[model samples]
Target: MPNYIETDYKTDPAFFRSYIKPDLWEDSNALYKEYMSWENNKFFVQVIKQFDKPLLRQIKNIWNYMGIRPKEWRCNFFRVLPGGNLPLHKDTMSKISVVIPLTNMTGELYFEDGTEVLYHNMTIINTQVPHGVKPPTEERIVFHMGIHDTYFEEVKIGHNS
Candidate 1:
């Protein structure tokens, strides 16, 4: 399968703004790194606590667009500082993961095959493979969601074990 696939949702500035805490976007705080977590690297934000009705509605739409009807899911708000890069790793936390960028930054998402995505929109990344991100000039913020993947079941039981 492909490493990533761009979703049908176009970038929505208003929707993005509605979910981001006003304090985190302040110029003075933009450079700071802040995130919530489920596991060591499974960073996430509780939607019910950090979002309103409208944002929740939009998130539901996003879940539908991705064809994910999960009984449970978690959201991550990543506030990446300037020149901050995540190490190469596989997302073992979930079978499927999606990344939706909220800010435009100059950076690259690199895969093991040497393919790099320079621009950001709504992209679904196959977390089973090795992948990583390069730091950008400006702070990068992205919303990441983890969902169940049946395909991962067999792989995890056989190859990963």
Candidate 2:
């Protein structure tokens, strides 16, 4: 389980650092209350399909790390329990996936990365490479997104490679 993380990625290092400190669950209810006000006064529960455009733009950064274009993008949140861990799994050895912990994050998500565990934020994860998460502290949460490279070439970030 500790032998399948892909280390060579191309995302802004700053993004990971910015996510170092987070705490959203405390205001989750309030956040939900005004969520509609966030994306045009529209109330969307159970998977907000199309979040604010800026978020979509941020997600584009994932393309650089994946080194591929995407066909589509989607996101979801997890109501994780204290010390709950997802089992090792693959989303297919070649597709690209992006996962970020919400502001309510408490623990860390570790990947095999073929050698040592690498914790990432706002970056691409090689789902086929095999990965999972480290049990987080109580009340921790996360957002996992899937992107299909092929239709995401135009989504660019200031990544020079």
Q: lDDT tens digits, residues 1-161, model 2?
A: 22223343444434433433333223233434332233212111134355566555666555554455565656655455665555454654235555554445555555555333434444445555556555556654445566654322332343522
lDDT score of residue 87 within candidate 1:
51
TM-score of each: 0.70, 0.50
**How high is the CA lDDT of each candidate model?**
0.60, 0.46
For residue 47, model 2's alpha carbon misses the true position, in angstroms, by 2.9
Question: Per-residue lDDT for 1-161 in model 1, tens only?
Answer: 45777655676855675666645433312221332121222222323246567767877787666655665566756655676566566765566666778888566878888888865667777777887777678867777776654332322211120
TM-score of 2: 0.50
Any runs in candidate 1 off by more than 4 Å, and if so which? 22-51, 149-161
